[model samples]
Target: MNNYYQVSASYDDVGNILSITRRGLVPDANCFTPQEIDRMTLVYDTPSNRLLRVGDLAPTPYRPYGFKPGVSPSAEYVHDNNGNLTFDPHKGLMMQYNFLNLPTSIGAMSLTYDATGRKWKKDGEFGEVEYDNGVEYRDGVLEAIYAPDGRLVAEYPSGGNRSEGDISRFVAEYWHQDHLGNTRLAFADFNEDSFIEIKDNPSTGENELEITQESHYYPFGMGHMGHGMLLLLQRIGTCSMVLKEMKTWG
Candidate 1:
């Protein structure tokens, strides 16, 4: 169990909290509190103490179930070999939940990256959503494939779906990032629909695509503030519309 002190607090090698707990001042100092964690800055460091991911945790108040009106009790942190809370298993770098933790009618940034590492990627999955995992870029761009049980059956690129290409083609066209700079996220109207493309990774990017079929349309604006406050303002409406459209489209 590694020690985690408040950003403003100090510590000693002997394991002494030289500063007060960040939670001492709920609604103010309690950055991890239900409200604050939902709207504070987050920075994760690697085992070498280098910054890994910077993002938020987001609040989960509107859920039909779970925390009535505050942060949910299901939140958790992810650690490398050093056990540093560099990532949130429930809420990855961009604050997106993983396959197991995602809400039925919601979404989260399921990918993230550091200086120049493949933080997360979509490996692909099978029917509906068996398992989708793959590789990612430093700027948070993701490239994941999906498979129902285990075989590589489907693929989702950063830009869009390449129904004509195989796994290698998916990697060549969508996986590689330009040296221009961090990839900025862009919405695509594949079928002239106003849906935000969802890459398997967390950070948004151009040319990204959504998987799972036309059944799932795009939901808008699902990210986190510094601490953990989830900014899901437009998400509810968009997600609802997408799901409804998918039901009819199918």
Candidate 2:
């Protein structure tokens, strides 16, 4: 059966999205019924027009159920004097920014930039990454090389045999992006078959493509839950560029 879904939004006088509602037709016994799947309410600072809360009606004393009033946790946003997002209740940490408005640190992660204001180094719980001349190094080992457009063109395996040559030593990867330039798919031909492999996944009980990674995002560019490809992209230095382009990360 074809699945049907509808989305509607209410806006404030200042053009701010006050609320969004999503509904879908789902099978209910012998008939299909329209059911509310999700809803989000946005609250903003009137003067600054900065988003203060999402999926909630008020500020302090968060509602137990957010938009549903009793089903999910609400998210709160806090900004600093410089308009930098200093805190997010969901993230559970305070973010710090540099004089240039570039993020300096978030939780246990720290970032460094070159003289030209380009991000060159990152150290965090995951590992250390160094960006040099479009190539990325993870924990002092060559990791990946990026194209001029910031795409992950190739990846290097640590301690791999190099006697064959550079081309033979690295894996070539490709990225499929959506209209908003978010990475929706990442893959590499591992078996040299020239065809993308597909097989049933025992864990998920579903057919899965043999790809390096796949990701899906919300309308505002926030990735959906359970898609961990963002970590891989961060390792390859692509996530930063994507976030910058989307203007979602600072």
Candidate 3:
């Protein structure tokens, strides 16, 4: 685990946090980060407030994530016009998102949306594709089933694949009303007991896609600091960068 104590911040003329330098960042005793896992600099297209690049730099460092030893460092991210993250040169993990910036695909997996803009389907890799493990959504209610490949699967009304036979994996992870779900993962871990924990191993310096910038707001989904405390933040797991502040006051 790494804990950041002192932090230095730089902002654009418009007051967007362009960079945050985390000093006194201490990893665990056995951490590979040499006490200087310094800064994650974010570049934005101010007119759109869209994040263009996230460069993770600290003096001179090696490639982050779980890459092999001695490899050179890499720029953190490369994003698309629609705000979809197209590349993460560090992990070789590339993804595409819909115009709304909802993730459509990661690496080989692909997602498709319905005419109404709901997630419709998620296709698996190549011929190995089967209906074994997938999710189905209806009227916005999401249900999932896990089976093996080559098995027939039913398609959900909103989008994605559903199970047709005995589940090869666990059953419905959980259920909840749509408004204001607060987990950082969104729905990746529906079950509370087994919420996914993608942590950056101090011993390994292995990191995953992490949200670096966040704000709390007054109105829903928008940043309005003039309103009240936490007016900029609506909920966790929400992408505030794309959610333009609606007004200065509620």
Candidate 4:
């Protein structure tokens, strides 16, 4: 028998509505697990359509799991004269600055273009740099990825190293083992070209330098808020190394 049911109703109390319940089912030989039970609730500000406080027997002291109902800290937004959403140096996204925001580093902006020619979000220093007329695009794709000063950091698939497809093309079992496993992250040179190499240990949250047969040590660049400098180093058909190891005292 499909044993599943919910009980709910409303009552008036101090200009609000209250709900109560008690539910369970007798177990059988095939299914011996005890039935779940949940009770006590309340609703307030009925006229305005709101649940202010719930209780015990009926519903008392309503407490939202993550947060109670209330107005959060106020935040201001920035917009250009055309009313386009702009990034404020103070408030980045979600009404707060990300941990990566550094005072020394010049704030950079990233603009995303949809299929249409319409300008979407213009963030950070992108607002500062005037768009050059020579910027190229092909088949709705930006042909040139440039720096703030208009220098070509990378071209399309052939020039700069930017893979736009599913990352599974590079990583094996990308999503499966995220814990202490043999699978680690490394920046593939693709053609064995000496560009930049990076590797990290998911278990220790540490990033380690991956070395080559020629004994070339590629430094691991740690962005802001990196957990630890430790790294998980591994070479296929070979051994691996760890950065900083933590030892237990007691």
Candidate 5:
């Protein structure tokens, strides 16, 4: 590979051991997706320990601001040594954490943390700045959320905004993950206990952007959607994932 990365694996039948090794660092291919890591040569000793490693590879130094960002190539983001966001490309101070290093607020949407550092409350924010901490966990429950950029996108409950809301009158987000525990689908609970989805109007076979809404994509963002569609198969809900999958092409 151009980055001087190589992957080699060996399986020992006698000991039932499998070993894998890598040469160089492989940066996160995409921002929102789960990262692929090759940090250590895993040696799974099923019955015996016959797996052997011959070489060593040290990872390159980490330079957060200096290294190429996974999402935005035009601007850089800043984080503390603990990986808490202090500066975002568009929204500054993505998440403000307490002394314990737990998030207290995501942008203007205030959050309350329990004694154990668990977020228990979230307040709405209607500021001009858009913020998403790439996670939405509150009141000891995780939610259906993901952030391709620095902003959050998820299904909203009644009175909750599609873009921002801290409080929820909804259930904890549920997920179905791949074999590697990669979440590929996020289902959201909307108003009246009904689900959130984009459907074609019966009168007109047009994909209404949830009524009076439209989304636009640039050339670069579109490129990923083209290829990501195959990977974004129908993974949830009736009349949901199938339609949303086609939306990528539209």
Candidate 6:
């Protein structure tokens, strides 16, 4: 029998989601008793239609940098005069933006854009990525090359010391996307075998595909935890580009 979950949402007059409730089947029970798995309440600025709070958190006024401390420090969303989000409590830092409203820095990571406002470089604690054309270089090493359709076609071996002609270099990857163009699976021939392999996963006690990575997302693009391997190629620059494209085409 297939188990299923039901998600219901309550929306305001302007179509803003006020609350979302997820109900699922009770474990080890034959009877159909819906058990609540998750619930979230969203609060918004009515006039501006901006999301102010999520869950049971109270909406607090925006605070600028160097503001005096009050009785308590609560999670608050801060926006600049141009309505650009400058701070998010979840990130725990004030984001700096350029004149074009493009984010320049967030915490330890810093970004640089070209003359046309296209992001060309990202330097962070993990590593640095330089975007040139459709290719990405990580710390002065060829990391990956993307297709015009935004599909990652190839990736090079890790480590900055490896050369382009190295025997362990250049792995081809294929992506399988859903109807909404969400990437669901990424597979590659790592062993150079003629066939893609499948093996038993000891952790989950299930047969798993030996693929590079796989991901499942919620309706709003939030990824599900513990469902697949870590996506090594996912980066903030790519996410920002995708979001910008979505906003433009939506």
RMSD of each: 17.3, 12.6, 15.4, 19.2, 14.9, 12.9
121-173: candidate 4 lDDT, tens digit per residue:
44464232223344433333344443332223223344544444411232111
Where is model 4 poorest over a 10-residue stretch in terms of lDDT?
215-224
**Worst-scoring 10-residue span by lDDT in model 6:** 59-68
Global lDDT for candidate 4?
0.34
For model 3, residues 85-141, the per-residue Cα lDDT tens digits are 787665567888766677878888877766566655666654223221254433233
Order the candidates by TM-score, highest first.
6, 2, 3, 5, 4, 1
- Model 2, residue pairs in steric clash: 65-70, 65-71
Q: Model 6, residue 97: what's the lDDT?
A: 90
Q: lDDT tens digits, residues 1-250, model 2?
A: 3223445688999899988755444344535444555566888997999988776343233222223344324656789898999987655777999888898999889999866689999999879989998888778766778873334444334576423244334556777877777777777766567887655467876555657677765454334333221244444675444343555575
lDDT, each prediction? 0.32, 0.64, 0.47, 0.34, 0.42, 0.62
lDDT of 1 by residue, 1-250 (tens): 2111122434445444333212111232434333222222333343344333332333333231111222433444544443334454334333233334431222332333333442333222321222224422222332344232212223445476444452333321222122432222222234335554555544745445643222111021222223223235444756743433446665
Deviation from native of the Cα of residue 169 in model 1, angstroms:
15
- Candidate 6 local Cα displacement, residue 199, angstroms: 3.1
Highest lDDT scorer = 2
Error of 3 at 2 (Å): 11
Model 6 residue 244 lDDT score: 35
What is the TM-score (0 to 1) of candidate 2? 0.64
What lDDT tens digits, residue by residue, belong to model 5 across residues 98-125? 8888777777677666677665466765
TM-scores for the candidates: 0.21, 0.64, 0.40, 0.21, 0.30, 0.66
After TM-score superposition, the amount by which residue 117's alpha carbon in candidate 3 deviates from its true location, in angstroms, is 1.6
